[model samples]
Target: MMLETGKIRENHKAALPYYYRMVIEVPEHFQALPGQFLQIQIESKTTDPLLRRPFSIAGLSRNRVTVFYQVKGKGTILLSRLQAGDSISLLGPLGKPYPAVPGPKIILAGGLGAAGLLFLAKNLSLGSQNKKSVVLLGCKTKEDLFLLDNFQDLGIPTYCATEDGSFGFKGLATSLLTQKIKKIPGKGTLYACGPNPMLAMAGKIAAKHGWSAYFSMETMMACGIGLCRGCAVATINGYRLACVDGPVFPAEEIIWGKLPPHPPLSPKGRGLK
Candidate 1:
């Protein structure tokens, strides 16, 4: 795909403090799937905060793209300053996108991990009657919640959990998932992305219940195009690359927190069925 540039059409903070959404115009060639991400270069070289960052597409339209992110680091803090009409270079519609499908859905997100799962919920639930999506969003407090109404507006049920008991559930989102795993049918699938701990927990839960799930990993990448091999991960058979293999995988296939002892041919290479 040709590298197309975009201008930020709107940047606004939602209910979440320091978490914002930047909507930019996507060129005609930029076709994005849910759970796909874009690499954004923030123009603040002198300042410690204006480095580059990657954000998942939170929502999409025919002409524009929106990314939602938290102010966790310097790069994001600068990108938050983008406003309507500000131009930015985007290197995506990159990476693989979450498979858009129908079934009882659960968007499992932890903190910033919500970015990848939110768009999937929005895309799949579009035009469904009483959307079956059950989005479990985890944060430290109510101030950390993102796009609460966006899901509700789509008729998707959403649940919020904060460590401080400032919202819906007072425990971890995985704990909430633990309780509901048995309720889903055979076709039910869990879509998760977030911190390592959250992903680990989800992996364990899915394995125990025999439920199908997809995971979007948070890996460090030097080159987004699968060349540098900096983001190699251990698989059940051996080490696998995250970029070319997957940023998304079946819950049972990944090795979890560490690389597998040996090299496992990536399910990504052959499209594991």
Candidate 2:
């Protein structure tokens, strides 16, 4: 991993629900992959917040890296105020990336989880000539949904679920996944990223159908690297560090019930901001 200071080219609200996408100009020599994350210090020269914030690489182009985030806490609130030409420190391209397994891929995402997984879909598409993929997204309402247009731009069929029936399906997105799984010719791979509860439900569904699934676990992390074990997650093999070992792992490896239901890291009307 490398520590570099990138200039902020843009930091603007790109969708509904007040989500912001920040674009940074990284060194031309730097490279990253889908699912890889970076630890960013909202204020490069301050100890107020102390810790660096971890964010997934939402998109990358040449030397430009995009991070999708929301003004959730004091740190993010500070980050959101940054404008064009500002600079931020980045230590990244960390964590294990999603495997590039060949198959018809089905991506399951809840709320802003789409931020990271979108890069995975893009990489897989570029790497394989015929990697058919689809995305199923879930949110509380239509306004909570984001990235639908981006997915469609990639030619990947997108289905959505909103709790208030303000969108495509009436129930949870996992219900749509269940219906889709039945129509597949054979076992397909599932990649999911979202809140613990949604992922837990997705894991159970994938297991029930005998489909292989990889999950991106979301947790409060003190350190983006493994030096601090604050982000340890229970698995069948034992406790694994979400910062280094994962942030991504097979669905079967997770001990779902042991994880409590928690709200997403993004701003969701919580007092975090």
Candidate 3:
């Protein structure tokens, strides 16, 4: 819940063609955990793009937080044009973090989802003496991949899968996971962050193996806080706010089907709540 002005010390293209990395300099005491995110205002004074964009913290240093993003729209396009020495408003370290689960740990990442999971991998490797933790990365093609070396540098066994057979495994990332999880020996938890479809698949796989899992969901969020109610996600307990309740949730907590279409408005023009 801290709102601070951070200087953009670095904004450059990453290994992937479309992805870019931005490094912001924060105060000394501002600490952020893995799986938490920052809400950034692209422009300092203008009100044009009214909402701040949410980006998961990819990596953290002494006083710098790094975020990896793709220039998908006008806001991000504008963000890409900014150079070093610029300043942006950042609101962050929000939402609950991924749970610290025991036993052997596995991380599954899809596409750009690797950005956040990288932080999680780093934390787990440093905190544990057991070196069995592994990272599974999946992408559409080899060109779509990034950060492979970074993960390997951490001394964790990292595997990759590509849909086109242009990389490690010839099928979906889950295929790699399926083959690997069997060798884990005992009960283990999986932490995943990716597209809804991929998360759903991983959830199903985790269930099939009787393992607990957590998923980091991606959605359109307006306010970083719960005030906007813009990021509601359907759960068994009813709708939950993604910004506050989670960008991360237990895999079993969500109702994975496409939400039923809302009812039509009444003749008086009042819509269903």
lDDT, candidate 2, 2-94, per-residue tens: 899999999988775468899999999989888789999888777978999999898999999998886787888888889999988999988
Number of residue pairs clashing in candidate 2, backbone atoms closer than 3 angstroms, sequence gap of 3 or more or interchain: 0
Weakest ten-residue segment in model 1 by summed lDDT: 264-273
Q: Give the TM-scores of the predictions, in the order they appear.
A: 0.85, 0.95, 0.92
lDDT top scorer: 2
**Higher TM-score: candidate 1 or 2?**
2
- Encode model 3's per-residue lDDT on 1-273: one tens digit a residue: 899989999999886445789999998889988889999898887986888999999889899999998767667777887889998899988887788888887899988889989888888878773386889999888876777887888888999999999989988988888998888888788999887877888888888888899888767789979998988888998999888998889999988895333232122322211
Candidate closer to the true structure by lDDT (higher is better), 1 or 3: 3
Q: Write the per-residue lDDT of candidate 1 for residues 74-111, one digit (tens) a residue.
A: 56656777678988877776677776555676888887
Pairs clashing within candidate 2: none
Best model per TM-score? 2
TM-score of 3: 0.92
Candidate 1 vs 3: which has more TM-score = 3
lDDT of 3: 0.84
Angstrom error of the Cα, residue 119, model 2: value is 0.3
**Off by more than 4 A, model 1:** 44-51, 127-130, 259-273
